[model samples]
Target: MARSSTPFSLHRLAVALVSCGLGLHAAAQSANPSDSPPSSTALPGVVVKGASEAPLSVGGFGDTPIAKLPLQASIVSAERMTDRGLISLAGLTSLDASVGDSYNSAGYVSYLKVRGFDLDNRFNYRRDGLPINAEAAISLSNKGSLEVLKGTSGIQAGTSAPGGLVNLVVKRPTLELTSVTLAVSERGTIDTAMDWSRRFSDGHGNDKAFGLRVNVEAAKLRPELRDADGNRWLLSAAGDWRVSRDTLVEAEVELSRQSQPSQPGFSLLGSTLPDAKSIDPRINLNNQSWSQPVVFEGKTASLRVTHQLNADWKLQAHGAIQRLVNDDRLAYPFGCTASDGTYYASSYCPDGTFDQYDFRSENEHRDTDALDLSAQGKLDIGGMRHDLSTGVLFSRFRSRLQGQAYNFAGTGNIWGTLPTVADPSLTGTNTDRTERSTEFYLRDAVQLSERWQGWLGLRHTRLHRESWQVNAAPGAEQPTRYSQSLTTPWLGASYAIDPQLMAYGSWGEGVQSDVAPNRAEYVNKGRALPALRSKQWEFGLKSGSRSVDWSINYFDIRQAAARDVDAGGGLVERVLDGTQHHRGIEAQADLKWTGGGVVASAMKLRARIEGSSDASLNGLKPANVPETTLKLQAHQNAFLTGLELQAGLVYEGKRMVLPDNSVAIPGWTRLDLGAKYEQNVGRQLLIWRVGVDNVTDRRAWRESPYQYGHAYLYPLANRTWRASVEWVL
Candidate 1:
């Protein structure tokens, strides 16, 4: 069973650090000149790998060591991704205790919750600081790193979910290299990819140079669920031109497509919870023999220009554009009904019977474009030194739906025969939504005294949205529009009591765009609600050394929560009547030896609804939010001379399924194992890797979420294995 995990002693350790000598700053600044940040004109990697550990740096935050900053963040390097086969967000959940699956399904866009709140797909994702729709799976083959900023720092993103921000750093051209990989899964999945990169010098003593990097991949995926197969392919290229020693230009383009039939999860058996152990994880609950797959097509491109304004300052401008199209087709299983065709309020009936719908939504387009301009460098006035970064961003997002169809097919049983129904007519031009926003941000890292440093940032944003139900208002006079503005501020302070240990605390606020459910039971269904505001504050202590690095964090996050309630009539309306408060403490430690490394993390969270109108819901834990989680990732080199061993453990605590705390799901633990072998033949290097997921074959529900007014129980995948061969050419 799953039990909540915590590190209660962390507070005592923090107190000791404060009372003793370590209060504000952890990692010592790099002394080697080579460890300095890359020139703004040069498009180099984020981290410098050497004998000693180097802190991460990116465009938005300048060259500061993120670990020493007051904010919370995590980095997944490209090497780790390739070694661990972490191509999707689902794989990341096993290593990060605070990340959770939030109604995410196969063959569709990934959804996640950080801490205890859901992330918005439209605003919570970024491509090198510019925004992009995470509505499609980003191909990791062309990515250099993934950065998760754990709070809505207005300096990073103008407006976004309070949960977190996910940034994808695409691969940039580098030294000459070529690699090819072929991978396969035990369940008949196959994948192949090729990566090539090289720099073409001007040959005039390196006055100018052009670098190019290309990635291509294809996959035939066989999912764990029956009839839920998929196929995917991607082609991406990134280039950089060092125009001069003080100027550089970079560009990237990505085109990809994925098609897979989504598998719907199981639901409660009508007022009774089914034993998760009794159900087979591979059963087909939402598929028929003949069905089309949910298709996703994406194209994205970006360009950036950077110049050194002077010896003390740098300026950069970046622009990006993206378009995503989805064709959703499914024979989805839904609510249950009596044998005599009587309607029920929930999913499955007592006898395991439920209704099915042939849902088809096609030609859904999401388009986004953004431009960013910033200057960051050292500044001095009178007798104070400041690391100041100022920027402005303009962005627009548009969503259009061209066709949709949702009609009842017939009755079906989980353990019996399923009915087949004819296709329904498709409607046209159903929805059109556009969002435009502009933001100006400023951040100043001040050197206050020798031991005390502070970071103060602010962002002012103006947003306008227009939504139209074209079907309901054909040839109408105008679309419903709303305009709003918000100014968010961020503050942080760090005291470097010593070089190895630092104490830091930060407070920030963010905004989220919430929408009422599209269900017909409510009066204001399918309407946009007002902007929701969220607040978060945390304090932490961290220490870094040659052999080890560790941090302990405590956070309190509060957000306005939406709920469905009876509005006196028979129908229910969605309302924001309460607040969701989450308080948690997390600890992480990383140790690296000569031939091995280990990462261990744990989170203890108490998330509940407060000040609710419904007495039953007050102080109740929200659905799908786990109380505790534990994760460990480890790798050992030289296990047998040129062989490496890898392992991971994930433990999730018990979680509630209903808002009223009427039902709950047990917690579970899973282990993963893998190995890698490397060999050098003549002039080429070859690597072989094999891994097994869910090695224990535990049968348990991974998540129980109430989405769109319905309950879904997503089961954990059974034991599966994968093997791959990589050749460095």
Candidate 2:
């Protein structure tokens, strides 16, 4: 099935591109440039010097400068990503204090946590401002920048996790050609990539006729975990055409595949949490022979069109399709200890043998399609200028899960000798699920006064879901359908104190549909619950200049909690009753100088600090989330020409390991260093880059307690080195 889908996808992509090209050509030949109205697209102006100095797109309302907007946002540029060797979402967690890893490991899916809440893969991930489900590894080679909007973003994304929204900006065609990079890491990993862009013109030298960009990358790596290895491949293409002076069309396609052997992280021994200070970071508990490799294949395609109807109005339309397949096999161990500190897998045994060792395997396939159409313009009402936007969005997603679990006979002790068990056959497989949603939204930003701007927005969303599983008995009850609707609103205002400073406040809400677990232990299993809602209030001050940028903000958010209710006779029902609240203060600063007096010819500094608490739990810090987090980085040009030095530090305060706050994990800090050199040779440029992470080789636990009732510990990687060279032709 997988083999056949690839070719069909490619064929569809070809057809779409050809059709768009023909349509564009026809329109360009018939339309006159002089008769077309002025463009009204509200795109942000690009700043090539650095990402921190640039403005970013703010969803359907178009782009706005960071300091001028009434929100907290951040951008990580391609140059910064390359300089720091940040190849995955996992690396971003260390560089940004506001983001953290939830359940991240090599050869598996990546999950992230923001502001003490989980960022859902189904609704919070985007590519080029369009939703694309990313439940597998994501390649960053073709991305121009990574932009993050913190806090409730329901106004921008109809339905999303309240934690935040992440957007990946795709690279576009440029006049200059870049060098090909060849890189290697200390863990026996090799990477190679090539990037090229070109602009095509007509015989009369009209440059805006067409443009194309292509990027390809391949990598093989031996993970830090023993006996684990993986490989990745990616190819991406983007094209743009000027249909007419007032109209434009763009298309993009990306194909990615990855495979790796499994190496699961460690879980706590029953209800007793072990002292994390005593564990070795390199230990692997699974049987090497029983573990299976995980494989992922994904393809995505998108098309966008924009046209100016008049001098004050512009219309835009976008459509995207994504498909992904994940195949995984794993051997997992579950055990607990007695009061005497004796370990048992199934029950407390005198011999300290593991009671339950299971082999689990699953295959999942997902398909998603999304479309968005919107019109935005400037209007004057009551002598006040207003930026108005209205949009409609439609999204459909389908997923099929086939999984089986087999319980083995053997057991192993957590503190004693480990035993190997044979692999078992599969037990059962079931279930297919589908979700669909449609939303309509309207927004307006009005200049209420000379120094005050007010913003108002609202979204009406309708969600529908369905799922089915084979029942064992004919009379058994099953839930196969669910539907819900919500209307979320946004209100905000910003007061400009001066040209370089602004004070802003906002009130917003987010909504998410709940998915039921397909487990037999629950009496109301597969019963869909009502949509969850979260509300947030924020106030902030922002100041920016050519050489410096700073922001400070305070926020409070509350969300309804979902938990299982014990019915009777070993059955449970899901319910939502309690509330969870998160309150925090965040501050960030960025400074850059060129040819300064007391510094090198080029110098840059970036820092962020945050403190948060769970207001619903008597100000206690949430599990797996630190109360205080800090990140600092610096870069400077060395005395030698074309030489640059870079360094960074990350510190995380102690955090609770359980909901009851019975145990805690110690705080830890890490340091990183790197250097890069670029030299021009005639018509070609050569560059060399080297970096080392965890320079002190410190061993610490990076994460704990991603799942309830289970305290899992994820250890940090040891000192690692990376080197790369690039040659431009």
Candidate 3:
């Protein structure tokens, strides 16, 4: 294990969080009513600011705004989070049409697929442009904003799925402020949080300045699923120092823990799609008396420094580290166990009988490190002006596992009484995995003319990976090692037709490593395969207007694909197949009026297999991706003095369950409604927010994902209601 350069203790963090929360709560209560000033409320996600073109950090297009960049991007501010009552990625991702769930379950860490590709949790998520592990439960209480780059991001992030990049920016210290929130839900869940911040100045100007912000939260989590409940706690702190007029330093640390039993998804009965309406979301197929809640504990810290070299040049250094662990214990229900003790393809018996197992996976550790040094500047080369950004980054990830147990317990009936289970105390298989990469990147923005612009970039990366058997005997088989190097390229051009309209085109290529899963079906399992490459082309038109803003983009992506192949009677081997081609059109439009606004996003995609090793595999659509997705969210200030009304709509087209297209999950649509009210009581500002999800109580199969040659189905959540109260001091 690598030692930490900066010491961090969860004990210290918890103590400090308690102390701060107590002190602030007392101060809020002790404030004299007669001395308090008047209070007022402002609409969330609505702000007035100057007209400045801010760069999309996730795109790595220095000095270029989203309108000028060749790709579409979205930024969700903190205020928007409050207005929408979105607290998890599951909620936030629903606002966009290009994203969908992949093997997501009720209490487990969620997984997502962007543009028809599963986003690698280890490489697709970042914190302030620094790589961080996302396998653990990520807390949003201390995030200032969320940025999503909608297309290929080879120029900024390396070796990632074409699904784009997700970045979390830490919240910084604002003016002196204190706020507390208390919330409850229909399922009897309770949540409370406190946010406190202050800024200190030793001189009038840049002589000396410092700022600090702290956030603490606790929750008793209760989901609609029966017998699957847990608790959560989080603590985070951020600080910044203005050393001089041209230089600044920022740092942040956070710790969070969650304990919730993971819910098992329903499955098909031997290639037969089950009626979603007949399945209840509250059913506890995995609820055994011996089951224990899954627990996840995570800690992360980051530091950044920025310096101004001159009027048009700047330098920056950033470093981030994350450590995470998960303990899983559950009575997992998987494939049906036949009378002969052989597992079958059916998730449940034809008569509704299923076998349960003491599925256990514990003592897993995942650690990550990311460091970068970059420079950005504007210069005149020959006759044309250019904006350039160059950077070098190093990323490393390590994982260690203690063992697992998948021993069968007993057979149970889905509708009848469930059988009791016991722990088998099976031995575990210990393993370790590590990956390291170093990359050098450079990007240039060239001014072709006043109305035309061009962008070019290239990145070179070298990666090394190793997998080990921790308990291998002496002179056993050697550990697996692999290395590769590649160069990725990006090109883009844009033409401004008018102040509010622009046309743009871009192309990029990226590479990703593939490793076959370690399973009993594959002959050559647990081995690394050749690196796969992918390319994308996109064209779009965007409009920026005061009353209306919109964009429409057409994109085509081609990627190398791989899948498990039946080698012979009972064994299988993973083979590198031909290619997967996806052609799609996506659009986003925003409309604003007096006291109301509407944001709409939609996508139409057609994904198919182009060339494959097996002749039968050609022309088949990939499983689990929706061909059509639409989302709409709107809010209006009601005629009532302090009330606002909100609505959301989601529609998804039918998705195939198997590559052969034999079974297809039916299409589904859902509706949501919400309202908020603000009022002043005495001298304090108070706000109340309430909302209901799945208002129609639609019982639908949200997604169907295939793994280990077995099909699994996940269902949508039941209709739920939540309400929260906020007090600002």
Candidate 4:
């Protein structure tokens, strides 16, 4: 394991200083209330307005309201996040029917899935519309909102996962604001955050000249498992300078570090699938004495410039770089057991004894860089208005891994108390890989009439990849290299039936580069395959009103399928053949009420439902994908002048545990409740919130079937409680 270059004491000192500064600023502002900016009553981290009424930057097309777009999208505001205590991407699944956890567990790496497809960290994660590696935990303390664009967005994102795209919009500097928040949760967890922003003008006292914002967060918590502890710290800074009336330059930098003891999920024991309800949800299988914690450190920086060439045209350029390192040690259990719970021949326990375990250690480093340049303008052709955008994107990613393995001859049973074991011997480095891609795209939106619009877009992408092993055997082949290029197109049309209703249909294409599986069983390992292509067709209707907003969409998607084929000599190779098809219908609704009635002081309701199916293999459902999903949330502020009540329910239908449809995992549902109180005292605003998740103390599996034949299960946490207080001046 790598040693820490900077001591934890330094981080604690930094946090203390920031907290003191915020307190002083708050006191100063309270003394001079007239200098304070207007306050917002909206619930923190929550979106109270519908998408059609909210302005957003979609697919880098510049700021446009949802009503004018022909796509399915959703925005989760910072206010909503605070209301639910959602601090990571995994928390998003509770509110979004189209997203779910993918191969993720507590106290470990994080991954997400959108629409039954994996959103890879190296290719699909983005911040401020720029790509970033999200394999590690991401801090949300400095973000304004989370935006999701559903379906194929290759024309805008270039090479990406076909499921969808997610962008984190950074919070900008406010003219005058100083906010501090303190939180406590179950398991003795403590969290603190501070946000401050200031605006500066030229000597002439002109506005819109320069602005700066800084946000800091620190948290410590005890893991659900015994003897495991976790902590994290984050700092972010953003600055903007208006060089002139028509030009603006912006820059941002973020640094974060997180560390936690390894906690491994459970994999299937042979062909005999154990009932999830029969196991203890809090059992820690990797808690041997010799185990080492995992630590992640990351740094990111970005710069952007925007210039208005004229009233009809604008130019924008952006570039970003990221670096991350992970130190991990784990004792992973594998292999299957017989009907009598007797283990078979497996690397985890070759003798199938209850007293032995297999352990492994891995250290890795990852780096990424991305650049984008674009031009957008409005043009009038023959009295028709058109919005056009053209851009070029380039990105590169590299990763290196060193691994070692050891066998503990005598450990413990699956459910028995673990026994101490000696530390594993170190093994040399193993794998190194790099990938790069470049793309150019163009898109245009044309208004045919007052109620009719058409859109067209195209993107050409080039991908390159190479991989090699550091410990190759004699006479091994040289490093593998792969390159490919393809062009994808997008078309859409929208028609307004009335002032409040819109109907739209779209057809688009997406592509993803494929790399050979790294498992030892793969015969043709480390060989890159041709890029996979996916096409989608969608139709939807959106309706808006003063009190209600709703949308219903139906989509069909098809993509190339790759499956593993077992060859001789205990080898397996992945081959692409038939195509996989996924079709689904999704519906969403948001309603708010404000009136004088007893039950209508202030109320908000949100709901989502989805039904999906796999049409590629005789209606066989895909692994880890539920056929149906539903979510409902409500908030009301009529009980008291300063109090609000919130509650929500989430449900997921049965899902397949394997690709062949031989086994299935039962569906589950959870309930969450929260409340908040807001009051003003001496020119300062104070808000207090409390929430409980999984109110029923349900024990269930959260995710499964990440690999083709592996039915690894990720368990959900038990009932957890959270409370927080915030002061703004």
Model 1 lDDT per residue over 291-387, tens place: 6788989999999999998998999999999999988888777887787777655557777878887788888899999999989899887677899
TM-score of 1: 0.91
| lDDT string, candidate 2, 80-162, tens digits | 78888988876778767777778787677778877767799989988888888878788899999888888898888878888
Clashes in candidate 4: how many?
A: 11
Clash count, one per candidate: 7, 4, 0, 11
Alpha-carbon local distance difference test for all models:
0.79, 0.74, 0.79, 0.73
Question: Model 4 over residues 1-729: C-alpha lDDT tens digits?
Answer: 443423223334334533443343344334533455656863444344555677657565566677667887778899888988987877778887877777776677667767777777777778888888887878888989998777777786667777788888899887888999999987788999999999998666677588999999999977456546789999999999988889999999999988877556665554455666776776776676666677888898999999999999999999999988877666655454444666543212322224344555456789999999989999999888989998888999898766555455354545636575655655333667898888898989889999999989999988788877654465452467888898989999999876667779999999877777665788877677776788998877766544455666667778777767668888888877556666666666665556210100110111111122223343455677776677777888857898888888888776766666676778898899998899888899999999998899887877775463346676667788999999998
- What does candidate 3's lDDT look like per residue over 1-729, in tens digits? 453322233234334533443343344334523235655653344444311134677788765666667887777777677667666666655788888887876667767777777777888888888888778777777788787776666777778887777888888888887989998986898989899999887586643389999999999988788887888899999999988889999999999998988877777775567788888877867677788888889999989999999999999999999999988778877778766665666467665667778878787899999899999999898778899999999999999886577787887655536866777474555668899999999999998888898989999988998886654455442467788887889998999876656778999987788677655577786778887778999877766544555677777889888877888979988878899887777777776667888888887787888788787877778889988899999989998877889998999888988778888998899998999888888887788989998999999999988766667788888898989998988
Predict model 4's lDDT versus the native: 0.73
| TM values, all candidates | 0.91, 0.86, 0.90, 0.86
Q: What is the overall TM-score of model 2 with all chains considered together?
A: 0.86
| Model 4, residue 207: C-alpha shift (Å) | 4.5
Q: Give the Cα RMSD of candidate 2.
A: 12.8
User: What lDDT does model 1 reach?
Assistant: 0.79
* Ranking of candidates on lDDT, top first: 1, 3, 2, 4
Candidate 2 regions exceeding 4 Å error are: 1-53, 270-278, 336-362, 412-419, 422-424, 470-477, 595-621
